[model samples]
Target: MKARSKRLMLVGGGVALLVAAVALVLSAFQQNLVFFHTPSEVAEGKAPTGKTFRVGGMVEDGSIKREADGLTVSFVITDTAKVIPVSYRGTLPDLFKEGKGAVVQGKLEADGTFRASEVLAKHDENYMPPEAAHAVEQASKAAATVSQ
Candidate 1:
């Protein structure tokens, strides 16, 4: 083959390889990406079922319950406009409590309960996750609008 033709072929091969690599990276990102949702979103059936994602909201008052085994706990997370029941089978964070902000990573069950694999509580008295805060604010605004 002519040198010029060989060089062009080599360049085309390199571009194809680069395109394939980029496609693979984007596919991985699409599979691994987890989205955050509020309790209202979950309640409205907007959250995906049987997929790992995050749900953030306040731990509803008087909604926590511990099983006799002591390792399983159930609680309700709420955005004041809606609530989702979450079941976790592990130790909870020290900062976790009712009426405080939390983010739970898990999959939604067929029965509408969230099966949590991990739970994260707000770290400080004055700090809430930005997603959780925004969810709460939006819920409050929605409630206000409904009441008027």
Candidate 2:
């Protein structure tokens, strides 16, 4: 083959490989991406099912229940306008408590319960996750609008 043809072939092969690598990286990122949602969004059926995602809100007062096994715990997370039931089977963070802000990473089950794989609590009394705070604010605004 001519030198020119060989050079063009090499360049085209390199470009193809580059494209394939980029595509692979993006695909992996997409698969690992976790989305954030609020209780209201989950109630409205906007959250994805059978996939990992995050839900942030306040743990409702008197909603925490622990099983006899001591490892399994159930709680309700709410944005004041709506609530989602979450079941977790593991040790909880020291900061986790009822009526405090929390973010749970898990999947929505068929029965409308959130099966949590990980739970994160707000680090300080005054600090709340941005997403959780936004969700609470939005929910309160929505409630006020409905009342008016």
Candidate 3:
């Protein structure tokens, strides 16, 4: 082959390998990606089942339950339009409380319960994840629409 042809082949092969490497990295990142969903989304069947994800909302008033195992805690998470029961087997954050915004990372069970592996409460009265804030805004709008 001509020297020019050989150089072109080498350049083309290098570019192809770079592209393949990038694609592989992106695919791996996508596989491990977890998304945030509100209780309303889960109720509407938009949340992923079987795979672990996140759900953020306010803890339902009077829904916190302490299991016999003390470490196991269950509570209902709600975005006003819908609710999902969640169970966690660990300590809750100091800021975690009923009727406050919180985020839980876990998987949704077939029985409609959330099996949380981690629980994160809002840092303060004013701070919440943007997604959680949006969910709360949507919930209030839904409540208003229902009452109207």
Candidate 4:
């Protein structure tokens, strides 16, 4: 083959390889990425069942129950309009408590409960995830408007 033609072929192959590598990297990133959803979103069927995701909401008052085994803990998460029951087995964060915001990452069990692999409690009394707080505000406003 001519030297010029060989050079062109090499350049084309390099470009193709670069494109393939980029595509592979993007695919892997997408597969590993987890998104945050609200408990109401899960109850409304916006979250994918059986797929792992982070759920942000307030821990419902009086909803936490520790099992007899001492390791299992169950609680309800609420975004005002909906609620999702979550079960977890592990030590909880120091800030975890009823009426406080939390984010739990896990998959939905077949029985409709969330099997949380990890839980994140809000940092302070006033701290809330921006998205979850917005959702709660919207829900309250919607309710107030409807009552009129």
User: Which is the leading candidate under TM-score?
Assistant: 2
RMSD of each: 1.3, 0.9, 1.8, 1.6
Local error of candidate 1 at 84, Å? 0.3
Residue-level lDDT tens digits of model 1 in 53-108: 99999999999999999999999999999999999999999999999999999999
Best by lDDT: 2
> Per-prediction TM-score, please?
0.93, 0.96, 0.88, 0.89
Predictions in order: lDDT:
0.97, 0.98, 0.93, 0.89
Minimum summed lDDT over a 10-residue window in model 4 is located at 134-143
User: Each model's number of backbone clashes?
Assistant: 0, 0, 0, 0
Q: What order do you get sorting by TM-score, best first?
A: 2, 1, 4, 3
Off by over 4 Å in 2: none
Report the Cα lDDT for residue 58, model 2: 98
As a whole number from 0 to 100, the lDDT of residue 106 in candidate 1 is 96
Error of 2 at 138 (Å): 0.5
Runs off by more than 4 Å, candidate 4: none
Q: Candidate 1: which pairs clash? A: none
- Between candidates 1 and 3, the one scoring higher on TM-score is 1
